[model samples]
Target chain A: MFCRRRNFVVLILFCYNNHRERFEKQLGEVAEVVMKAMELPELFAVFLKIGCLAFGGGYTVIALLQKETVEARGWLDNNELTDIMAISQTLPGIITVNAATMIGYRRQGLVGATLATAASILPTFILILVLTHMAWGFTDNPLVRKAFTGILLGVAALILNTLRKTGKTAVNTYADGLLALFTTVLLLGTGLNVALVILLAGGLGWVKNLYAEKRGAKKHGTD
Target chain B: MALINLFMVFMKIGALGFGGGYAMIPFLEAEAAAHGRVLLENYIKVIAMAQVVPGPFAVDSSAYIGFEAAGIPGALAATFAICLPSFAASVIISKFYAQFKTNTGIKALLDGVKPAVLGLLASAAYIIGVKPLYELSHSLASLTVLKAFLAIACGYFALTQKRVRIGTLAFLTVFALVGILFF
Candidate 1:
């Protein structure tokens, strides 16, 4: 037993001696990144860039966020990002913004959350403001009007495309499909408030789940 | 008063627009129509612009709606209001993530909300598309038919194409050029 212990200690010393330089270098790199991620300014800058480049659907930004936070800077790992993403979905509002806020809050607190959220939306806000101004100026020109007509068609097409993608994931059951159809009819055919309609649909869903649970419990008791 | 109303409407949207961006469209359209401040045509245009621009769709739509209702202050107010729910929710969730993540009630609610969001998007699409499709002229030479054709073609490509961002921008640019020269 003593000889075995001596051999194990020799192996440990050999490994330590061989990899000491690389180990220290890795530690220094990790420390630098930890510092960078902890700083409020750095957090703002990263999220700002993320906002500026996060184009297309909300899902697209998730990849970019993961890339920036997990792959590039090492501030988070895959699992932590996944958790943030899952948490973001549970709350109201944009997933990307929610994610930014969560990550910032985790690192720094309310101020960090505010700063990160602001940075994420800043570029888009300015761009939209500028575009709106330009659109106002061009509203009267005949050619611009013609172009807008075409753009309107494109907008319709875009919405339909979104519908297709969202429906694929959301409508997994017959009840879910029926719920969607009911919503479409109510929103299109009635004067109901959109928020109220949404809440009503949610209530129906809750009731459905509750009923299903009761039935399952009854079946178990019978068994 | 206009700014306050705009802020309130968007705050509601932010608080309830589960699944975000695309889901917020119906709420924005309905609220804007309720006030009759921003025209439906204009709101659709804003959606198109939002698609091409960088950042979240919700942010762009709120900013445009605010700008339409009350200029710069309106824009700021709407933007801040729409974002406030997200900010507040994140803080709350950060505090209670463990419990929130496991809550079945919230899960079931979201399950219902998801399908309803799909429905909302469908209704909004119908509202936006009816005008162009209904007005398509019979003449082959007219731009309306061409516009309809191009829109469908663009949509088809948008669905199938791998590189969405560049493809979308290209399609829009082509549609614009076709509009300019054909007319």
Candidate 2:
């Protein structure tokens, strides 16, 4: 463990040495941001970029933010990004909105949070209006139906791709894999309450942990 | 009364829209159907637009239904209501980020919740796909060779290619337009 810590420190120092100039630039900007009062326009512009470009929603926007904040803006590092994504997933609303609000509030407090939230959803709101109108206007056109059918087909594949990615993160063990499979069957084949399943599965996780802990303790005692 | 009803409907949708984004599509469709203000086919088109358009699908669908029900006020109200729960959640979450991140209990619970949500997401995809990709509206004979080819082609392209959503959307839009000119 001590060697591991030393190696990690060495790795960070090596990385910092490699990017010494960039690191200094980032530190100078960080100090500047800390000294200045947060501006609403800046906040709005940043979030507008995130909101508009996140066409695929969720992770696509998250990836965009990762690029902007980590690579370009130097606001967050890899560890911070992972922590934020983890927290956002636990939140009840759209992960994108949760992420925006969190990032805003972290930087500029309540006002920043408000502006970011507004900026993130504003493009979506306007786009929704335009789409609602287009749907109404094009209802008589059979071509619209055909195009939508094709879009639906594409959406299915897109969703499957997303599922595969999420599954990689969510399924870590045999137990997790079994739970995922069961939940899939329950949802696809039956009209069971999803809320109930979530609660029950969560309970199962706790129970599994407790059982494993007890077994490990027993083995240690025998040893 | 209509405005209040609209608010309540969307609040329910937001509450049940676990996993969020396109996962909410199935829930939004059911709620809109229950309201009986729009046909299923029309609602499907609206969902497709929400998917193709550059924004959050959950809000887009809510706004669509709200506009269908009452107009601008309905649209605004429904969007706000549906977003309220998550906004509230964000406030609490951002404040307690450190504590929540370190909590083993929450971690264990999320272990289960995440996979269950995964199932819901897959279920959403299955429900949406079955009608458009697999089923025949009129009869088995109505499922033409051309329709199957187009569906497979779109699905394969999207599934295989990177960043094909916008390209596929543009392609399908033109495809549909030219299709009518030919037929």
Candidate 3:
């Protein structure tokens, strides 16, 4: 009986090891697919060609995704696409990649998400990586410098535009505007940390909401 | 010393960066200041660079900070660290999201977070816009002032104007072209 129990323990250990190995192999495969998708021309070709061909940047990308995934491929519905966009923006990563991952996962599970993310990022990553390398080599090239200057100006414009749109959507009241203004002054004037600015803004927003609620209650009582 | 310090510091930042990239800025700034590796002005410049670059603004910004703090290795480490949490979170969350799709409490929590997210976004915009205008005013440059005014006007137009779809980009491109040519 003791010998039989020893044999049973050995069998259990063997099964556990097999299971662990299979799990590890699955994870390895996922990582490999993700990395390999980066170099796959067909995968990146779609994203790169679309990005290059498209006129606008951010919204254009959204439109392109709608066309490719919804209209052309019929991978997702309009509502699903919109939902993905909303969730993606709330998340920490790049919105485009986040959207791609969501759609991909919806279509083909974990492997799809990995491939889609790699594909979506491939174009920008390769372009920027190449540009960074080239910039280092051609540091003294006047044309390169001029082009960079132009790019910087373009970037500044893009940011300003983003701020405008974001402000319209985000700032709804006098209190919100004041909070924005206050946070802005603190950040730019004093060169306070961005993290601190965000925290303080969040805290102040909560406080303002409380104040407003209390004031409303008092007014209601008076009425 | 600087590079190694930056790698270690940003690794900590990445580990703690839960909310978003913007959420990581204060921690980054504190670490930089503590090390005396990066000056405040340069730190702001790094933020600006991150904003200008493509991809996720926060990740790019963190990478830029790491690079500025040390060099290439610093950039790699910082980027990796910053990206690690989101990557892990994504995998874990993806697994559970389907299960929680119909959970009312989760929905309510998400609703609560929405207004806060809006507030954060608003705060970011205001912070970014004010800096340049303040600097331009301090310099007392007419051209800078004009540019600042144009930015504000463009912002207003973009906000109020409904018919124009690309109003923001239009303002940006025009101002940028003008700045490049004249300023």
Candidate 4:
């Protein structure tokens, strides 16, 4: 009688365990779906805030993104951030946008890419729209006009400063400097289409590279 | 029609705009002129103000240009169009970046393209500065020209020189204030 009672108790316990396991599994799946739903919105909010604070230019945003994603959220580590930045630099786009797309793509996929890109741009889009409209209304004011003129002078300085900084990187050799000068004259003097000018420059660069490579090969062959 | 033109113009700018925001200035000016959407001086002024405002230079300029062209819709179109190339490029790179990163051909192309971009930027700086310098030349004694000169000199010194390290935004704000008070 004792053995039969013990078997009955064991059977009840086994049934309870099976039901509980099934219930927990279903609950976990639901939770996962919910988390997936929340992720895109969370991504949008984070990037929108980043967009608002991404001042100065694209390069500055790299630090901002690293701070938010690595330190605050722990979505990425330092090495990943560096890799993303390098890839962004290699591609032909704004680094910030490229980084955002890459991060989003890593996290979710193509939908995330589109969402993050839109979020990153939305704040600037809105801010510029509002400022431009207001500036239009205020253009009639002479004080505003004077301020704009002054800003123009400041901008010229700023551009030249940028030119100085960029020139350091772009113009390494004498040939590069000459090429830069050639580009300036070609654009300003001829008023050529900027796109065509860029293509011409790229073609020139490729041909130059090919020639150098062949010469190097010949030197190596002789050696 | 204007919206389509704005989109195409910016798309071209995006594909070609390699160096950074500043490097794209010449392209923006040239495209706007070619499209005949905005006045040259007005566009330049917008670019100037953009320096003071906080955001990516490309996005801010695109919005203003689009708005000037066709109101709110134009702004949206241009902004989206400008970002499209970057997005597409990133997508492809994200997939194949391991190999793409070390490609010699791309490295060589970028090598040649970068100097040309610098040249383009230099020409833009000259175009922007020529008028102010010309005015300064005529009136060495005028307060307005002096103020403009002071702004530029101080900005250049602060940025390029190591000792007087003021931030770009801070420096620009002070000059804007100076403009309101004196210019």
Candidate 5:
């Protein structure tokens, strides 16, 4: 019975991975054909759906956006979505805002982007407000304090998980590796501006990419 | 605590917030310390609310601080201010994206930017993780080690990426319940 139960758990995980793989395959094949043009109300509604329910912060919601736009809605192809992710990360704020702004702008226009931004934050704004009210009394309460600590621990785990996943892909080449190392040191070690660090790092990458551009052509030669 | 000052503080933080939500933790903490506005105990609540809320942690935090400082209007101001830089950036980038989507120069720039983001995540782990995990827990004597270990155990599982987000939240609730019951 234990063996059967364990197998069932494995089966469920397998099915989920398989489902994701299938979605990815389809996304690759058909991403180019359909371009969803959503109106203001429709745009607001879609973002609202994501904003209200999607938790665990910005990076966590990237996958949700991928599912909603690339897989389900076909608002953007996988390539465009990848581009958006990269761009969003490079920009400021959070992944949620950056992603929403890019996606909304791409699908609609200025108004579309504004609507998306508003929709994305409205849930959080209201929610924090509610929690703030509840939070007042909970401070001296030992139970809630202990619970908060526990939750913070869990949050730590989630962040470390994301860091690992992102690091796997982000730190690829020798230059990239060095860049990652340096960035980790600089940001943590010094009071240097984060924005300046980003700008300078991007500058370095640009130079490296330029150096590699010709070599890259020779290596890949297909593009 | 003028609304404008609230907005400006957030705007500056927003500008500096390059890595992501968690990466901005130190900046927020500093602002809290410098201003002496949010008491440490209350700030725990800020962090709590920041974590539990649906948006980015940084954004949620600013809203929390804003509300703490001023009121609903302050919250609105802070929220609006933080969103300003990113929104403007998005608009500018959107305009240029089409013209430069495939441009080698733009691609190269973003390429360099990517790894640094990875670095930020590393720092985020240290900067954000230390406070609640070690600092706060140390104050308690009984079962401090056990509580810390429980957190570590959950964090380890969380790293497995098996439904990470909701999984973390689930584990948090379960651990919280356990904490309530046991410790």
Candidate 6:
């Protein structure tokens, strides 16, 4: 019996040591990922790159990232990508970079986040830097001006398309449609502030929901 | 004094800029007016430039304006200042949201904000659209009517179309080439 008990204690110690070792290894991996991405200049360049190529704003970037990272590289799964997109939209900062960072962090921890963000932004930053330097000299160049005009028209089309798509998803009910129309009128007709409009809309939406809930509860109670 | 002023003004913008970049415009305009460092016309130019450039419109524009105002350091400072409040709020809200994921009140509040946010976005789009369209109409050129019709058609097409592909870029490039060669 004593021998058996001694063996059991040894077994417990062995299990504990093995568990600790695995935990340490996982932590080390996470740390390595985080540290790898902390380089500022390289990461900044990545951001610039993403900015340059990523047309149609937030959604476009999300889809591109998914194709490149999730499908091509197998860095993340669909569900995870969706979750990050949702969270990124809800948060502030550039949504694309935020999503990129979150996905990277999830995949390889910090280093991944940093590298991914840098990779995404680098193109835009460099392009902008070059453009800024040349803008004065090229400001009146007919070809450059024409090119920009065409790009602007394209951008307008893209934005209008996005607004329609976003509206379809966001404006589900009559109340939502009314709210959108009202907001549009208020903003366009008057110089009503955008922040105030959002706050008011958010507040109204909450109140409306609560009122509906209470009414439902009362009806149920009566029944 | 100027740098400190820049910091404070941007901090206010950061705090109040809900519903993302475009939503921050009026606040930015008001602040820019107050500072007088940049003229309203110049501010509008910066916004236009921002829209044409990539990434989040307001943030990138802020950086560009900062660079214009005071160079690289200024750019960094402005960017940091504008993002500070949103970053803090996001981090805090994220923590709170994790704990209260299913709380009805929280959910209701978020639902309430949706309409308002949409309103803000819609308003920005309309405002941006109006200026360009008006300018085009007033130009009295032969192509003015054509451009106006095209713009309206694009808006309608966008509303009806199920999908808008990047192929639009190829069309734009072709149009640009034609404009360069013919017009």
Runs in model 1 lying further than 4 Å from the true structure: A1-38, A217-223, B37-39, B131-150, B161-166, B177-183
**Superposed Cα deviation of residue A134, candidate 5 (Å):** 2.2
lDDT string for model 6 (B35-72, tens) is 46445444554454454466666566556556666777
For model 2, the docking class works out as acceptable
Q: Model 2 TM-score?
A: 0.76
Candidate 5 CAPRI category: acceptable
Best by DockQ: 4
By DockQ, the candidates rank as 4, 1, 2, 5, 6, 3
Q: Which stretches of candidate 4 lie over 4 Å from their true place?
A: A1-33, A213-223, B35-38, B131-151, B177-183
Judged by DockQ cut-offs, the docking class of candidate 3 is incorrect
What C-alpha lDDT does candidate 1 achieve relative to the native structure?
0.78
Q: Which candidate is the best by TM-score?
A: 4
Best of the two (4, 6) by lDDT: 4
Is candidate 3 or 5 superior in TM-score? 5
Candidate 4, residues A134-180: lDDT per residue as tens digits? 77767758787766666666666777787787777777778777778
Task: List model 1 lDDT by residue over B85-131, tens digit each.
Answer: 98898899898888877877766666667777877777666555544
Local error of candidate 1 at A197, Å? 1.6
Which candidate would rank higher by TM-score, 2 or 5?
A: 2
Put down candidate 3 lDDT per residue, A1-223, tens digits, no spaces: 9999999999988887879888789999999888656534444455555534333345666788888778886777999888777666555544555666676666656776666665655444444344544545563455543333333344444544555565565567877777667765665457666556555665666566666666887999999
Model 5, span A1-223: residue lDDT tens:
9999999999988887879888788886675434344266778988988888777765568778888888887889988888788777766677788889888888778878998988988888888878888767866688787676666555556667766776786767898889888887887788886657766776786788788886888889776
lDDT of candidate 3 vs native? 0.55
Residue-level lDDT tens digits of model 6 in A1-223: 9999999999988887879888788999999867654544444454455566675467667767676667775766888678767766655455665666665555545565556665655454444545566664664587855554444444445545555656665667788778777777776677665557656766777788778778987999999
Model 5 misplaced stretches (Cα beyond 4 Å) = A1-38, A58-82, A186-223, B37-41, B133-150, B161-166, B177-183
lDDT of 2 by residue, A78-117 (tens): 7888877777776556777778778888778878888888
lDDT of 3 at B144: 54
Best by lDDT: 1
Model 5 per-residue lDDT at A199? 63
Candidate 2 regions off by >4 Å? A1-38, A192-223, B1-9, B12-16, B37-39, B132-183
Better of 1 and 4 by TM-score: 4
